[model samples]
Each structure stands twice: as C-alpha cells, then as structure tokens.
Target: MKSQCKSVVTIIVGAMFLFAGMGFCQEGSEGKGGSAEWTKVIDSKVSEKIGDKGLVNFEEGYIEAVGIGAPPEQFYGKPQARPMALRAAQVDAYRNLLETVQGVQIDSATTVKDFVVESDVINAKVSGLVKGAAVMNKTYLSDGTVEVTVRMPLSGLAKAVIPQAIADDKKTDMKEHKPVPFSKKPAPADEVYTGLVIDARGFQARPAISPKIFDENGAEVYGTLIVKREYAIQQGISGYARDLTSAQSNPRVTDNPITVKAISAEGVGKTDFKISNEDAKNIRAAKQNLTFLQKCRVMIVLD
Candidate 1:
C-alpha cells in the first residue's frame, strides 16, 4: 500500500509538469491573431514600452499592455497551476490596459480618464471595452510564471467616448462649419492633392483623438467642426507618423498630398497645430483637396 501511494503521487507530479510544458508551447502565439499583426506595424523609427502600464501606438492604431503573473499557492501539487497563472496574467493585462488607455489624449484639454471620472456611463463603457481587448500573445516561463499581451483599437475607444463630449447644440453647429472656398494658392496649384500633411517636427506636437489645425490668425482650419462625424468616429481626427516620408506614405494621406509647416503647437496637449496663414489659406482654397479633409484623410508628422 505504501508503494502504490508513492506511485500515485509521482504520476500527479509528472502530469503537472506536462501541463506546464503545454503552456510554454503557447508562447508568442497563444491568443487571437497572435503577435504577428502587432509586429507587422512596428518599425525601427517608432518606440515601444512595457511595464505597469502599456503603450499607445498611434501608428498602429491601438494601445497594448503586457501582464505578468505567477501560480497561486493553492495551485501547488496540481496540474491546474499554469492555467491559474494565465488567468491571473490576463487580469493583470486588463488592469494595465485600463491605465494606459486612461492616459490617452482625447484632445489638447482632456484625457480618457477625465471623461470617465465625469460620467459613470463613460466609465462603464470604457470598462466594457477594456474587457473586450484582444489578447495578442502569451508566454510561460520555465520558472512557472506567465505573461499576456492585450490590445485595444484606438478607433473603438474614440467611437465610444467622442459622442459623449459633443452636445446636440454643438452637433448642429458643426454641420454649418463647412470648408471655405478660395482661389489663390500659397505657392501654386502644383499638384492635384488628395490629402493634407502637416510637418510639425520641431513644434513638439502630440497625437490626440480630436486634434485640430488653425491658422496663425486663429481661424479653424481642421477639426471635428469640419469633419463628418461618422468618419471622425471611425478613422480618428487624424493620423500621426514619426517622419514626413511615413506620414506622406500613410494610407490616411494617399496620392499627391499638400504638405504644410506648423509654426507652433497650440493648446496644453500640443495636439492643435498653428500653421502659417498662407498655408491655411492654401489648404482651404485647394477645393479639390478639401474633400479629403472632410473624410479625415489627414496626417501629421511629429518628431
């Protein structure tokens, strides 16, 4: 009877090891579409971060977090240890994603956290979205630890939050904010432009969900006021890239695009751009290109 009991204990320990090995096999491709999709969008020019909070990759159109976890004491001596650790890791990922998301800029003046704090409805919706973020990758360490990476689309977050920021009266006003028609060009009608690009490299401009562009004189050049609400909620107010080449090549601004220089970064978040009056007038006058602005086909190049 003593020998039989010892054999049973040995079999249970072996099974736990086997299960832990299986968890290790899931590394780099454990969930959703795996880490490939995220990696595809990355390049040497862009930066990546991982820690208590994750990162917001505007170029990739998403925010992501990496969660670390270990087996609970109760799971010792059982085959379920690794799985419990994975669950804990997922919970950690969710919390980290929430923190990273709350830090995302909604505009120069506010963040997602501000909206959440002001409205219970927004808080609940944001929490739901966090739960819905995709688990992109998972890894199991030989020392019996686990890590999970999760991602959430920036567009999804904007769609859920932007509506709440706009009032019915404001929506009516936005409808009337149409592009002005101008005939003179800043330089020349050099190209039949399909989109607009703002080179704000030295201005220290940053990304935002609803950033705007203004002329030196303070006239609005681009923002939610001139954008179609549906488009704004889908593609975001604009696209951001690290360099001019990337910004011009971005799908957000295809074909021949009109590139303008930003004289200053406006507002506290540095999301709003102040372009020369000549550039602003040229953009508004490029009637053929104004159509793209309405569709949110704009890109901003930042350092």
Candidate 2:
C-alpha cells in the first residue's frame, strides 16, 4: 500500500509541471501579440503627430500643445478606463500649454524666472487662458493611449493677459488713443511714407503680450491699446517680419514705407516698447501733422 501511494504522488507532480509549462507558453504568445499591437499603435500615433509632409502648422500668432495619456494597470479592464485616459490626456495638454506660455525668455543667458517669481495670481490666469483655448485635435491609439492637441490665438490671449498684467504691475498707465484718418493728412514727401517699417535685424525681436512703437523722445506712437480692437484681433500682432519681402506681405503694408532701426526694448514682463531713435523725429512729425501715418500699416523685420 505504501508503494502505490508514492506512485500516485509522482503522477500528480508530473501533471502539475506539464500544466504550468502550457500556461507559460500561452502567456508568451499573448505577450508577443500585445507587443506587436503596441508597435503598430505607436507608429500610427507618431505619424499623426507629424501630419502630412511631416510638418505641423504652428502659424505665427498661434500657440499649440499636444498631450498623451495611458490607463494605469489598476484601471485596465475597467469600463471607465478609456474615458478616464482621454480626460487625463486633455488635462496634460492644458498643462503643457500653460508651460509654453509661462516659459518666457528674458535674454540670451536668462529667462523670466531669473527676474521674477511666479505667483498664485499668475497661475490662476494661466489656468483661465488654457480653459479658453480651442481644441485642435484628438486621437486614440490601439495601445490604450489617448492624445490631444490644443491651440490659443495670440490675439485673443493678449487682449486678456496684457491688461491684467499691466494692472497687476502698475508699471504703466494704459490709455486709449484714437487714430486719425489717413485722408486728413497732406501727401508725404518722396522719402516720407504712410506705413512704418522697423528693421530689427541682428537682434531678437519677438511677439509680446503688449508691444508698442516709440519715438526717440520716449513718446508712444503705436501700441496694443492704440489700435482698434477689431484690427488687433484680425492682425494678431503689432507686426512681424524677417526681411523686406516678408514685411511687404504683412497686412499692415502700404505702397510707401517709412523705415526705422530699433534702438532698444523696455518694460516689465511681456509688455514692452520697441524704441527707434532713427525714425523718432519722423514719427513725431507725422503725429503732429495728423498725417496718414496715424492710420498707416506697420511692420517689424526681425533677425
């Protein structure tokens, strides 16, 4: 009877090992399939990010951010996992957007953080700005990853942020200025023109929350608040250019152009003025004479 009992135990142990081996084989096959699926999903998602011709349209005056999310292991197999992942991705996208906007570059060797600390008020404003941003695209990958793209028009964003920043800093008093019609002024000389061009080559000249044009005496001739609200919204910039041809393409351009070289930039945060002593006298003369320059188109050529 003892010998028979040993034989039975041996058979049971052998069967157990056989079953374990079969389980491992099945698991290995499933893992291989899962890895293949993961690769396909990743490839497709990357292609989507690149878009046609592998280029993403980050047009001037528009800020865009992309985010990705995947469900955690604990949430996997749950009915709510897909939706939760998507929501998490959207939140991630907004956080990225905030970081992009808040990460302001101060100079070649420094950034905004070197000059000022971020406060709760600034965080809240950034949150509001993200909430108002427009949704650009959304995608789901077979590997359980969700992706989202969001964008905010700089024109609208500036209208909201600039005034608040100025109010908080109390650095400059923002007043409204009415533009006189170009028809009111007499024709300019051969050298004088209706439109304004600023040559900012050999230096960094970027878009800001509030950008202004100043004369040599430090008087403001053109600024964010000076332009009509509709015009600002439509143009989305005081002006920007890399060269004369590009400057001419600006919506603010005209047949004749008055050119100037930028001397310096000043003010706190993203709100500043680009000063030009070279054309300051001309700008003052134009303003004093109530020339068409008051309503003329302007462009800035940057390096």
Candidate 3:
C-alpha cells in the first residue's frame, strides 16, 4: 500500500533527470528549401533545435519543454489525482526547460550554462525566471500520462544572461574603410537600407546569442559593438534562417536589406562570419544602416 501511495511527480521527475544527464541528440527538420525553390516554402519556416528535453524555436522566439507524469496507483481513481498529476508534470516541465536554456549558445565560445555556472547571482536569476515560464498547454494522454508544456521567451532569458556592458559594445570605425560596392545597382548607397541580410550559407556558420561580423582586414563590421543592449535583448543580436528568401522576407529586416555573402566562418565555434572587404564596406556605408543596426535588424541565412 505504501509503495502504491508514492506520487509519480517526484518519482518521474527524479527518473527524468537521468535522461537529461545522458543528453539526447539534436533533432532538426528534414528537407530544407534551397534557393532555387525557396519561394515554395512557407515564409514562416525557420530553423528549430529539438531534443529529448525540449526545443528552441528560432523563428518563433521561444523555448518550449514538455513534462510528463502520471497519478500513483493508489490515487489513480480519485478526483484529487488529476491536479496532483498536473502539478507533477508542471514541475517536470520546468526542469526540462532549464536544461534546454542551459544548452543555448551564448557566443562562439560559451553557452548559457557556462555563463551561469561562472556566476551564482546569474544562475539564481535565470532559475527564477524559468520557474515563472508560462504554462502553454496541458493535456491528458490517452495512455494515462499528463503532459504540460511550458514556454520561455528568448528575449527575456537573453536579457538576464547578456550581463554587464557587453550589450553596449560597439568598437568599429565605419568611416576609416573605403566603400566597396557589392554590385552595380540603381539603388544609391544613401537610399533607405532598412536592414542587412548576410548570405552565410555553405560557410558552416552556426547561430548564437550574439555573433560578430568581420571584414577581410579583421575589422568588426556588425554585432554587439553597434547594437544597443535594449534592442539586442528585444529581438536578439541577429536572426537566423535556412533560406535567403525567408531571411530577407522577414519583417525583422524589413524590405530592401543590403544582402552580402560571407567569405568564411570565423571563430572556433563558427558563430562569427568574415565577409569580403567589398561587401563589408557596403554594409557600413549607408547612412540609414545605423538606425536599423541599432535596433538589431539583421538576419543570417545558413545551410
């Protein structure tokens, strides 16, 4: 009787950590749209990192985790059991979300977990934030398990993790560089360049919380250095996509984005990009670029 009275929430949560420790493989969608056929795919289609613990949807700007639990044998048929099972699932969901956010890449070199581990203050704050994550959905499974989904906004999580004056970082001198045109076009350089889209595909670039862009001469072109902490925390340092069309079409960048090609992926983590001096100059030259870049209006197309 005592064995049957044990609550599944506590037991299931404990058992679930075993899986977290082992870690599951990253789950990604199959059949990406190549440039030739990008229009056919939905504009809303974007990259997602799914794992056994939870998922981070880059397009939708949220991290989600699903927690599962079941009522104990003794309480299975009682009215109080439903709430008990739901509570267990909710607890389990928060735990899963913690693991998911921890895995988020902060830069080419570190992850959110790495940052939090280095500071007990930040660790506590992030934990508290995750606890308050919204309960997006709750469902009673056909097989008896109760599942709950909790969602955490990326913007909110980033605000806490960004830390210090790093968000105020901008160390580039746009005036020093000579203008190198990306192409011969009717649009003048002074025209309204609403945003920037870096076609970084095939360079093996990966997304991060913040990433820097450099010219061939190793001068910084874009990133935290130019973007304000407020905007970076709002829409992230930059958005990412699997196709050029989707990336440019995104409202984040708006219309008429200055498109450029990346020369190579920089940094050991491949989170930063190096563009040709010519393309880099074009990105820096526009008078309107400053306003948009400040708001973090940029996108990267990845393979």
Candidate 4:
C-alpha cells in the first residue's frame, strides 16, 4: 500500500511539471503570434483616458483641440492648468498603454522641441523614431505626433524579455537602456517687449517654444523675441507664413483672418496669422497682403 501511494505521488508531481511547461509554451506562442492583439492594449488605454476627460482628445498620436478657450489676456508661461492636466494624463495614459503592450522594444526617446505657443494656438512638437526588426530592415515613424518609438523583432531577447517583464509586474526592463533624448524645435511664446515694459502675453501662439521676455526691471513678459532663424515647416515645400500684426491689434477682428508681420527687428520668418478658409479666399481675392516666411515687419506692437 505504501509503495502504491509513493507511485501516485510521483505521477502527480510529473503532471504538475507537464502543465507548467505547457502554460509557459502557450504564453510564448501567444506573444509570438498575437502582435495585433497585443498592441490593442495600448490603444484601449489611450481611448479610456480621453473618454474620461472630455476636454482632451487624441487619435493615434494626434492631439485634437478639445478644451475651452482661455480667458482674454491670460498669461502664458510653461502651461496653464489645462495643459498640465493634459501632460499628466498623457503620461499616465502611456504608462498604462505600455503595460498592455507585450514585447515592445523602446529604442530611443527624445523631447520634441521647437514648439511655439503665442496666444492659444499650441504648435507643440512630438518626437521621431526608427525601428529595427530581425527580418525587415528598419521602419521610421515621425515623432511629430507621438512621443515614443518602438521596435519589435521577431526573435530575440527583447521579445522574451517583454513578456517576462510584463507578466512579472508590468514593468519595463529597458529603463536603463533607453535611447538619447530628442530635442524639439523651440516654439513661440506669448511675451512681447515694448523696450520699456515686457508684456506677459501677446496672444496665444505656441507657448512651448515661446520664451519669457524680461524688462530691465526684471519683470517677466509673456511675449516672444523677434529672433532671426531658419524656419522650416514639416514638409520642406511652400514656406509660407501669415503675419499676426493686424490680428493681434484686434483680437476680435475675425474668427479667422490671414494677417502677416515681422515680430522681430532682425528680419526672420514672420508669424502666420491664420483665419478661416472662407475669409482666406476673400482676403486673397481682395488682394490682401499675405505674409510669407521671409516677409519682415509690416506691423508689430512691442508694448
């Protein structure tokens, strides 16, 4: 009877090992074959966050305007309460998204630079990326919308490590191996210099790239400096910019108006004063003066 009992125990232990190995094998198979399903985890998290916050919207990597307009003459610095909320929400969203993505390799990360925010228009930038695969060569994606670049190789330690890291505690093991930080282009701000008192804000431009202007009294202004620099749009074609002088003078001039002016003395690319499409044709049809990239100082109120 004792001998038979020992034999039964041996069989039970063997069965346990067999089941454990099978479970591991299944997990491996799922990781290898379920790329689409695995990536959905990221999408779901992002969507959930957006739904919770009605003022913020995101599709794939593009952030849409969802919040209400800012109060008139509101000061612009780093970001107001709304942008702070968005930033925090975005980070949490991405963190949750990463938790769901198994076997995703982050090769590099950099802050998207050169964002300009004058009044309320936020021209924020995103990061760019390059992906490497075991089979295919490399894939490139623009960081202009998203903040991360991911690489997925068919076979390698990254694949195995991804599953292990996630299953263990939804942790990323590549924190130490992250790539270099990407610098974004400086954006426009809301400060303007009157050569006497620096204004806290001009209008809402791309506040991210806009710098704070200071008077000799050390008072901070929310306008931008008229610095001369090479301005390139995302596409290297049709380098056109509308002026913001007339529009700034009359904040309520039009819902959308195409105005142009050089904000600086050195003669760089002028700010693009964009209006609605309907008004665009009217303005152009009337032979209204449009400011392209190189047009200098038609009108700029420093004070």
| Residues 222-261, model 2: lDDT tens digits | 6543444444444543556556666765557666666677
lDDT of the candidates, in the order given: 0.71, 0.48, 0.68, 0.22
Query: What is the RMSD, in Å, between candidate 3 and the native fold over all Cα?
Result: 9.8
- Measured by TM-score, how close is model 3 to the native structure? 0.73
- Colliding residue pairs in candidate 1: none
Q: Candidate 4 lDDT, tens digit per residue, 200-300?
A: 12443211112222222222111111111222112111111122343234322223333322232210222122223333222223211122211211222
Higher-lDDT candidate of 1 and 3 = 1
In candidate 4, what residue range of length 10 has the lowest lDDT sum? 122-131
Report the C-alpha lDDT of model 3 over 6-45, residue by residue, as the tens digit. Answer: 2222443454443331222122211222122322322444
Best by lDDT: 1
Assess candidate 1 and give its TM-score to the true structure: 0.77
Model 1 / residue 280 / CA error / Å? 1.0
Residue 40 in model 2: lDDT: 51
Deviating ranges (above 4 Å) for candidate 4: 1-208, 223-245, 249-303
Alpha carbon deviation, residue 156, candidate 4 (Å)? 36
lDDT of 3 at 107: 75
